[model samples]
Target: MGKTTVIHHAPLVGYPDDKLYTVRVIDGVIDGIEEEVEGKYINGYDKASVEEIDLAGKEWLSPSMIDWHVHTKLAALHSNRLNLSNCQSASEVFESVKQALNDPKYDTSLERNLVGINMRNSNWTDEDLFSLEKMNELSIERPIFLLYNGYHSMWCNSLALEVGGYGSSLNHKGHLVEQEAFDMFPKLTTANNQVVDNWILQESKKAAAMGVTEIVDLEMEHNIVQWQRRYAAGNDYLRIHVGMYTPHIQDAIDLGLTSGDDVPHTDGLIKIGPYKIVTDGSLGSQTAFCHDAYPGTKDNHGIYYYPPESLSEMIETGLKHNFKFAVHAIGDYANHLTLQTISKASSKPRIGSTIEHAQLLDIEKDLPIFKDLGLIASIQPSHLVDDRDLCHKFWPGREHRAYAFKSIVDAGIPIKLGSDAPIAPMNPWEAMAVCITRAGQGDEKNPFIEAEILDLETAWKASTSNGKTRLEVGDRADLCILQSDPLKLDAAGLRAMKVNGTMLGGRWTHKTF
Candidate 1:
């Protein structure tokens, strides 16, 4: 921690355009702020201050984005976990795997299996996890797992199944969907605590570069222990709220956990978060537990991982342990069921909950329920760009309902935005652009659900914390100093805007200054 540090003559974001202000901070907390005088700025703090970074040339300063959902480890777990994000065909996926096979870390032995991630196959002609079948192309000889882009499904070879202790439980071989993937992913990958902790820090630095100061990591394994260790090892770069997977709820209760308890001491950098429960599937996998059968599949109503009674019981039990929820729902039917279960079990409990995704919402039918219950809407706007084609293909004739951002906002619900990183880019600017433009990165001509587009102010408020005092005289100095005005920039400019610095509690986590 340092003495009073001043940011001089920077345009304060989310405010009137004509004024520039000098801001001061001390010991990781905001001290005071004063507007510029006669086209000049003066340091607000004492002249005896230890240091000052002149920001007279800086373009803008605003609160750094808070990512509501991210997978800390999956962002970049290993050097060999192939990145196939934009791949369009099955052949591209196989090529990436083959290319990654060149890494000396992986060998031909089935015991030392290979894994790849972010391959999308829904729009491909083959629509299979891999191009070849029956472990052909030598795919069967060595185990390999190609995770889908949305992480709703996982495709693995026969050797992967046998080597990972899952072959005996199944009669057939195919992509593991929803709960199977949820339960089996950690098993398939070799768990290395140190490797994962280091990976989490490296990924956090990438997020810091994007002007993000806080993130909630809802990765499906036991996250508390890993985060605790990281903080103990002095890896605190940005604030992290580690979430508990529902299967580990009892473990959390056994440990006497509360939402904001620190692990030894993280200097307020680490906190406990809500319990994450995946109650539904995703549209890309054609298993979102929809109200009607998808146009292409027969008798495919989709899958509900939780029965109502069981889900309600889980919520009630979690409430007993002072835990809130972040329930996953992608389909209309799933949302309806989630609301029903929450409504039935939510009373007499004091913790708040958010329905994650809420992608395919029946606004007219569900908005009232959400309003009456007073729940938070944790949405990922960037998913719209990636899901436009799939939404139309799988959830046909529901263009208006899919990715319904405007409807949810208009209903006056509290909105929290995130990237669902690794699933999406974790870039706040790109997320904000897609939120306001209905356009994907580098593809402005194609807009999905044009009416759902938001204004820059609203998008910024949703993407970043607007602050209780709006960065007044005294506030926590979490900020992102940029080189351009977000409101003045177009989608491309916004996406490409330069981040001069990012501050987590008045300390420069990532800074060019």
Candidate 2:
């Protein structure tokens, strides 16, 4: 028989308050759960072979969380990049880069490029927007690449553009959007395997510390080989689902790889996730393919990365290859067109497909269609914290329908929460806080679209594995031990809740006990 491990006096979140719970596990699966009367005298497990942990009612236990949408590779790359999120204008960004160049840590040699990330130009005035001439003024010898906060645009200097094979005349402003930026991303951020692996390892440990047991890494590159290499190097803190893009679909099909197929040599730690396709741009980039133009523009309905027919063809092909689809749709028109494409595909996806970031929806129309289509909504609530002002500025008069979490739940659509890491922090607690309060971090007084705020229970469920609210028998032993009861906490308390330990398959990935 497998060794029995018993956890005693656990305060299970969302469970009965008057009773203490004892859970037993065998072979990394929950075997049984027993309720004990509060204050009852109980003896510890005395069996010679039994492993025991007595929480003594000092910790709250619940299912570990899952980040359904994240760009793991990009997150790792951004870990060391110069942060430009705090820069308010193009001049500030250039000044910050100039200062970083003087710092000994940043490399400015001709062979290497200086990279900065999280630049937001959505709220910047036209005069403050980045220009190629200004970028070239910094240095002609050193290449500079600045990634926007939304990951949909990049601002590069003349040398960087030359390195990326783009002529200066092609984009005088040095700004690349959508496919243009995506194509040049890896070229500028390429690093040795060992370096990237170390970065990913550090980021994985950070996720484990935050009680994240699983993540769907939707990095905009073919990730299987990279993940396999990482797993071989003992970087296995979290179970990862590696999502692929449309460009790699033919290769995946030719290799007979399907969605949910486990990569060899990883012991099920990594699996092929979905066939991801970006149908539109992002709100912060002012290119989300909205139904209406920006408040000041006429006949400008944003950009569509893929037309409806092209998207339909890709979905049909993916369905034939047994791949689940994850369509990136932010604006209402993008979501509407994605739904239409999926519904009209030649074949239906056998497994459940997901809409990545169904951010702005014609809620009254798309909610029912989304539910009827049996598609899951993979959302990153922390995006609202960042995009709140952008939504107000670019998408005025449609605030009520943006990031409508409560409405999605009420319509019976399965909603999963993530951080879209590197764009936002990969913290489930922060996501939950934002979802429950409809406010940004540390600023609950100014709630945006309060009518769409989710209840605490709904937000908690969205953050957990398979939306499980409580630990139960027959469940996997992926658990998170918390310093306090999340059920009794407000938004501030939830964001500040400390994690005592994290477990995966009965093994402690992180522990303070």
Best by lDDT: 2
Question: Alpha-carbon error at 292 in model 2, in Å?
Answer: 0.9
Candidate 2 residue lDDT tens string, 172-270: 579888888888878876577788889899999999999989999999887888899999999889999889887777767777788888877899889
Per-residue lDDT of 30 in model 2: 81
Error of 1 at 359 (Å): 0.4
lDDT of each: 0.77, 0.85
lDDT, model 2: 0.85
TM-score of each: 0.92, 0.95
**Model 1 C-alpha lDDT per residue in residues 1-513, reported as the tens digit of each score:** 466677787787766778878777787777877777764444433566556666774578887778888887777563346678778887777776777677665664422667777776657996544432634464656678778778878777777667556664675465688877766667655647776677777887888888888888888878777777887876777788778886776777777876656644566688788888888888888888889998867889789888899999888887777776788898999999999888888573343577899999888999888877778788898888888888878887888998888888899766778888778878888888898789887677768978888777777777774433146666688888889878777898888888889888877889886
Number of residue pairs clashing in candidate 2, backbone atoms closer than 3 angstroms, sequence gap of 3 or more or interchain:
0
Deviation in Å, model 2, residue 59 alpha carbon: 0.4
Query: Cα deviation of 285 in candidate 1 (Å)?
Result: 0.8
